[model samples]
Target chain A: MSKEKKKPILPMIIFGIVSLGSYFVLFNQEGLVTETYTKGGWYAAFPILTAFWFSFVHGSFGSNLLDVVGLQAKKNK
Target chain B: MRKVAAVLIVILMILPMATAVFAGGPPPKNLKKGIFLEVNEAAGTALFQDSTTQETSTLMIGYSVKAEDLKLNKKMMVSFEEHDGQVFIKTAEVMFLDLTLTKFISLIVVGLVGGLLSGFIGSGGAFVLTPAMMSLGVPGAIAVASNMCHKFPKALVGSIKRYKYGQVDIKLGLVMAVSAIAGVQIGIKIQKVVLDAWGNAGSNLYVSVVFVVVLVIVGGYVLRDAFKLSKNPAAADTQSKLSLRLQKINLPPMMHFKTAGVTMSAWITLPIGLATGMLAATIAVGGFIGVPGMIYVCGASAIVASATELVVAFVMGTYGSIQWAVSGLVDIRMTLLILSASLIGVQLGAIGTTYVKDYTIKLVMAATMLVVAVSRGAKIPVYLQDLDWATLSPTTTAVLNGISFWALIAALATAGIIITGAMIKGMREAKQEVQVEESHSKA
Candidate 1:
């Protein structure tokens, strides 16, 4: 099922960089990002936006982390 | 091909019919819909107008409030009188719309960790998210709504990953999800009634009691089973006698599940799903019982049972999110924030399953269940005090609350460590095997 292709490493590296960058932007400076999220109502937009942002970025990081560590699910078909 | 088409048709038909049947109740006639105009204490009436119908109505809001404290001009919500009766302002809570950057960061951090935990355990981290949101000044209903909104997508992602690994039983999951949704509706009704009659403190006490009792009993049984299997790994493969007997019951309308490799009466499966849904509504930990019930009672292996639970969670979560969204209570931020980490966490957990023996899942599940039981159990005394049944010292109350919160953190940490350790070991072994095969091919 793998088709013997060369394992792609760049996607994993790009994901890592972006994930860390987002984390820094959100967490730096007296928790401004978190404070804005809890202000309620329309401020809730902050949390929703960040969540999607992290899901793509961190999700890719995790997926590739598994790949780099040689932990893919067995291809039984 | 005919059989496949027949199955698809049955699914399509049942999906709508089941929804219509479950949605049988009439809409709340006394549901007050309006924005508050003024609070008049002398007449004890809160002036409100229906936003949709554009009808002005003076609603005798059931609860008492001070006249001067009413906020005007902001969109305030109100509920109704008898069927086709006058609408009254129920409780006009303020809707604020300012968020600092700090809350955004916290949601991501919490969401990532929560997602990671959910990915690993199949259930958890949500209990903390709801409370965390509430602590961050979100209302109780909104916290739950936001959390529910996030859950379905996370479960969907997790279920797909596990399905790829040959772990999910789609047929079993659908059956369970359908029944579970019914259970949730009933559970919600019961909860609403309790809250109305007994008030918040009483409702909280009741929830704690159920959480403590169910978790302890279920957790104990699972722990015992895990220990037994650890002592004799071969025993994991053996079918339980009860399940063996259940398989023999030649009842009509029997259903077959390929991944689960079992065919049983629809009647048998429905109750399990119902219980899962009801418990989910009550405690938000449906997977805790759902997975074990499928394994021990329904006789599927832990791998398939736990994986199938993701599908059930997805279906239920989506329904719940829509309901919450309709009310505009779902804080999309909280939902997506949790999804961020949880999506990844679930994938990792699904893959982790491939490396461990069936008994290992049991061990992790039992350990989590038991520890979480302790967390809930610690809160019982606090609830009892709230009910005024017992008088406790302030220090003792504080200590118990601390223990309850910390225990939850401990449970997550322990589960995370164990799952990561097991996955690492499995990955190493798999790589060694791959290397061996490559060298052999070269030779």
Candidate 2:
């Protein structure tokens, strides 16, 4: 159980850093991002791709963060 | 295990085929695209620009219309009429640019709170989110589409978090989602029949009535049950008679859900999902029914039911998002902005679940539902006025709209408090348990 618990921590920390870093870029650079993205046609892929990309990265960060905080579901019913 | 996996794959493969066959006709292309440069009333023609290419064009009027009909400098979608070999935009309806910075901020805030509520209660945020978007000046279709796009990823994250906490029943949730998709098709068909008969106002009235009535009835029952359970604290952990009766069906092709701890016929399971999908299509919140159906009809405990809802949400949301994305209506910035906060909120709510009993979910869900019913109830009068069935003074109309908006805000805030309070209490108790257990092990 301890081993299982420890496994998620390192990945969580790494993901956390990356997740926060990406947001810093996206939110701060909203003008450039929005301008480039809303150009229409093929460029529309920017917003869609970005949504999916965050789902994975931010999602992982959240999952690991929970595990690192020792908040896991009870094991073995 | 392999056989179980095989069944899952088979069920998944059949769902899309079923939806395509039964989901009825495609959504109407109500998009009217054009830009106006000038209104020429003398010739009854408007100098307009095509939205796509921005090319200038002249359209002659078919009906007798004045220059004042066109709102100058405002881009409008015009109904075209060809008269005397010349095309004219007959009715120049301005394309409303209702999106404001304030609305954008409101969307993000509502999305975050809704995400938190969803994480705790299984499915709710959309019921409120869609209306919130509408109030923010998003067109009805765009609001629903954008909300759907946000839903899938939010559900994905929420599901994973809850799944980690032993709340999700993957096989069961997937099976229900398939049936729910089929149900959405049926619901859409029914909507078309109503539309054909009574037109748009009638359809809107029908939807509002259904939302008000269903939410009131179901929400009331749930509230009563929650109250009763609270009174008898020991009963909080027990399953209901309806749940037990559902568990005893034992018909052929009975499926076992180990986590939910129930086995029932696919027949029993399919209808719940169908109802969920139908409601989702109407109100954009399928999980409200889906969660309760699992608890009362399928005999799953609240924990599993809520967790599984995230799965259903993920599936439905994904399909719904794809439909919206294809229409090019999804505003990705809005989707991401909401996700940023919601991802964190969902994680917090999911972990919060581990610290409370099943009834806590019930408490939050019932409260949210009842408050939301009030919000929708407030809108009935406005729709009534729209259809000319009833007349309201401006003050009354403003008051009604105000109450409707504030009630929605109240619902969000109420749910937020309940969830937060319960989570904190649960966390404290969980910490105590861990400390006690550690001491015992040391001794």
Candidate 3:
């Protein structure tokens, strides 16, 4: 039941930027991350939270990108 | 009233199973997680600090351990054994893996294809990804842990997409997931038993045998059923006789799943969940069995069953991730790298499913399963070589390993092709139909 968005390109670019930025930050601080994230115990939430954040930002971007490319689900028949 | 009762009963059944399993804690493996506080090569000993207890121990350097590789003040996971009343370090690994360009690209590629398969069929990618990571020099536990960490998110994104298509059955998926969680415990326990009994080679051989046997049987049956359904479209919507008979049973606590459109006793779904959990624990992919079980045993259509599987995957993956996380083994960089591509692949696959028929899902799943069976089957002889049960030439072992890795690639590639082809064809036909309708209306 996902209706076609009027202009997915704009939102796609925005999300793409955010997702890429997130990755950039993650890679930029690799040593700090690799240390803290793998510390076990309550530090488990770090990875879980990161996974959710990317899935939302990156996931939406992927959905819209697919829409822009005309690779969409069949309209409700 | 009955539905609530049935669900509660199911939960009651699951709680005890989970507690019983969790109570056992992880098998008493000699592996410990901590940091190397100091090393004295001349003394043939190292002072190690336990992360949890803040206690230090003097561990003797075993013959297999490379003393030079031990860095002071670095967090690590190591397995040690008692050799002649002295605790000896066996293999020590740095907690985090060094991800090079090669490792990054490979993770992304596998994640994309694995995501596509998961979005379309609701389960896949773990089986090959774990081994693929190991090949890239990741520790076995870390590879499995990182792969699991990625799986939940991918499944979350995928399930949402599929749910939008109204294909996912929340109640049924939850029912299966709760039990599947318990089953993972048993699976881990069984794995521990195997490892303790026969070591790595024996474990690999056990996993490979189970992988090949299950895939051949389930995949073969699904493929056959797909052919039958494709030829006879009228039978597509009907539940299997097994499902129908099971549904007819006048059992107490019969739960009605609206999305799946069948009412069945809660008891029936538990075994499937347990089996799925056990297989997932053994082979790293439960969707191979989960989807088929939902279809044939629970009487859901392929579309619904596959979509619902994402829910199960999400729950199980999250649970698995937490377990790995508590052990601090999840490699987030590898997880995110895979997600970088897989998140896209999953959505694309989810939409692709909307453009195709149910049979296409089955066909793709069957093909992947059979090829994956080949991938694991090829590794059997090499595992045999390791166990000293069979002496394989070096060339033979190398060739077999090559075939095994490539065959996994083949499985994903085959599924990707089928899904893409079907979606494209479906889109073309839909567009053509729209154009025809527009023309007729204008006239």
Model 1 error, position B277 (Å): 1.3
- Summed over model 1, clashes come to 31
Give the best candidate by TM-score: 3
The CAPRI-style docking tier of model 2 reads acceptable
DockQ: which candidate is best?
Answer: 3
lDDT of 2 by residue, B1-443 (tens): 77558857876687567533211123335544456677766666778776656788787753754577666665454565567876555455543443468865787788778888888888867777777877765555555656666777888888988886678999888888888887888888788898899877788788878877887788777788878877887986677798788778878888888888887887788889889878876766677788888988888888899889998888777766655555455555567767877777777777777777788888888888888878878888888888899999999989988998889899999999998898777767766777787788889
TM-score of each model, in listed order: 0.77, 0.84, 0.91
Lowest summed lDDT window (length 10), candidate 3 chain B:
B19-28
Q: What is the TM-score of chain B in candidate 3?
A: 0.91
lDDT of 3 by residue, B1-443 (tens): 57646665776675545632221123224668788988888889889998767899888894668678787777788887677887688889877767788888998999998899889999888777888888888888888778888988999999999998899998888888887777778888898899899998999899889989999999999999999989998889889999999988867777788999989887898889888878777877788899999999999999999999999888777766776776677789899999999999998889888988888899999999999999989999999989999999999989999999899888888998898899889999988888887788779
User: What is the TM-score ranking, best to worst?
Assistant: 3, 2, 1
> Pick by lDDT: which candidate is best?
3
- lDDT by candidate, in order shown: 0.70, 0.74, 0.85
lDDT of 1 at B291: 86
**Stretches > 4 Å off in candidate 3:** A1-5, B1-30, B33-42, B47-58, B68-75
Q: What docking grade applies to model 3?
A: medium
Q: Candidate 1, residue A14: CA error in Å?
A: 10
